[model samples]
Target: MIDKQIIDSFKNLIDGLDVDEVYKKAIVDFMDTYDGNNTNEFYSMLVAVSGLLVELKDLRIVEHGYNLIEEESEKTQDELDSIIRQFKDLNDGKLPPDPMVSTLEEDQVTD
Candidate 1:
């Protein structure tokens, strides 16, 4: 069985592999500021897990026959926004933007 830390590290590494310079920077910036010990690495794990969830959902869409990316994106965004709000609410309502990097941007960076 893969260790949680190893999984997390791999996730973080994948998350940081975004091609779009700006998006890559955004994700990295968040991970960089993340307080791993504060909430048992909740924020960091949230980012990684959320991303993996999106990918898995996408795969299901491709294999199981569904076109729910738009709907799923909205729902996911809502949840992410709420999480951002939680951090902001605890920190005087100031919040950063999305932490996930765009695959389009990453592809562009690669090409």
Candidate 2:
């Protein structure tokens, strides 16, 4: 079952976002394609269009591949650290007892 607190928090986050002009400008290339309609000459127009296409391809950021990979990695690292801390608490800040030490003690008792 989903928790009510989590649902409310997420809803609040969605409600608080502001879409300003700077954000719109960042996604301008996505909203429209400029075909170099700036020039009357055909070849000159194509050169402008090609430059825009290359710029689009070279963009460092913009909803690329969903961006979930880095987020998931950070969550995984946090979980691992938590587990290690719990283990250290259980073992009194030392390594776990070795299985071989128990077997050797048993052998000495039998001999």
Candidate 3:
């Protein structure tokens, strides 16, 4: 009984209510860099993302789930960085240095 366009517009309005500017920008950036030729990586990421969406829906965290994910990630990163800095402060300057990089002292000693 409802107009098709009206129904479609209402659906879009509901679907887009939670999507803000940052989400739009992220989608644009990701799509801009997406490699269509790599079907394997594409499907892997697709499955992972879809699974997360389903889980979020099951948990009733549908609309605000995206914000929660980012907030939790940032909080985790900050905590990890604090721990790393504490370890570095307690230990010498060589507390878990990058294995891939060669320091000047090491390079000189190797020669």
Candidate 4:
């Protein structure tokens, strides 16, 4: 009854999307509160949005979900790497470890 091609197609689509981190976080949150049944519109929408979490459990669907999760994890890693890189100072090799605090004395000295 389940269409393998359909599931595979959906998985490919999700895998190619740039929406992995949010998708993973959303899915985890949804699962944390999921009741193994769909009674709320929110849950239905959450599942519907993800090719992996769709209302099917066929092999193709599983593959799609797997690909989606893999892509998302990769994307998340890339984003984290970029963010970390952004904070590095190439010239000085220094990065702000905490919020900066300015006082009246500092301003007066500049003036």
Candidate 5:
């Protein structure tokens, strides 16, 4: 299953991107439709969507001759890189175990 940490990281990465509020919302809404059991497919979809957002931002800057927000493009790219790294760590079994999982296990034991 796709873990909660990955979902939260993806949300943060999307929020950090230089996109319009409407577009961002749309992206998040679309992400919600994915089945969390398939981590590889989800990661691939996220990469594609992130690339599209970057391309759109770059196009906007070119068409308008100035960035809508200072350093937005660079910031978005950096966040994307971070998100990708997290995904890799997760796939390699390098990510720390989720705290909630441990908490739940404790609760079950006590019950």
Candidate 6:
């Protein structure tokens, strides 16, 4: 389902990172703590993890000469901030519609 896709995307996003088992456990626990019924919480966590991945990738880029453009870093930071804001909004009970679900609905409507 769409919820699985969100979790899968988060896992894929962190595929190359060298994070500790604790961090990984925390992610799993966080995901498990929320059922798919709460799309806002699920996506908030997803975006939060994505932001963490952005920071981790930034650090890796600096550690290794990965040709990461300065503009890209800036953009990623901006995105992290936006993601944080969205998470906060979700926590505040402003449930934003899930993008994947919305797209699927649109496609079904068209069909």
> Which candidate leads in TM-score?
5
Estimate the TM-score of every prediction. 0.27, 0.35, 0.31, 0.30, 0.53, 0.39
lDDT of 1 by residue, 1-111 (tens): 335575468457646553445554565565555555556565556677568656765776686544566678888899888776767765885445655444455556542
Ranked candidates (lDDT, high to low): 5, 6, 1, 4, 3, 2
Question: Distance from true position, residue 78, model 3, in Å?
Answer: 41
Compared with the true structure, all predictions reach lDDT values of: 0.61, 0.49, 0.56, 0.57, 0.77, 0.68
Instruction: Give the per-residue lDDT digits (tens) of candidate 4, residues 26-106.
Output: 655544454444346543564567656343335656789999999999998997786566555433677656544443475
lDDT of 5 by residue, 72-100 (tens): 78887987787677778888988745432
Task: Give the top-scoring candidate (lDDT).
Answer: 5
Global local distance difference test of model 1: 0.61
After the best TM-score superposition of candidate 6, give how far the Cα of residue 26 lies from its true spot, in angstroms.
0.8
Better of 4 and 5 by TM-score: 5
Q: Report each candidate's C-alpha RMSD, comma-separated, in the order given.
A: 23.6, 17.9, 18.6, 17.1, 25.1, 24.9
lDDT of 2 at 102: 29
Estimate the TM-score for candidate 3. Answer: 0.31
- Cα RMSD of predicted structure 6: 24.9
In model 6, how large is the Cα lDDT of residue 105?
55
**lDDT (Cα, tens digit) per residue for candidate 3, span 1-111:** 334454345345334644445544554455446545665665565456446545655666655787899999999899778767767765775545434343448576542
Error of 4 at 85 (Å): 0.6
lDDT for model 6 comes to 0.68
Mind giving the per-residue lDDT tens digits that candidate 2 earns over 1-111? 334454345334333434344533433432234343433453353345445544655553454544677788888899778667767876786655542232345567652
Worst 10 residues of 5 by lDDT: 96-105
Give the CA lDDT, 0 to 100, for residue 81 in model 3: 88
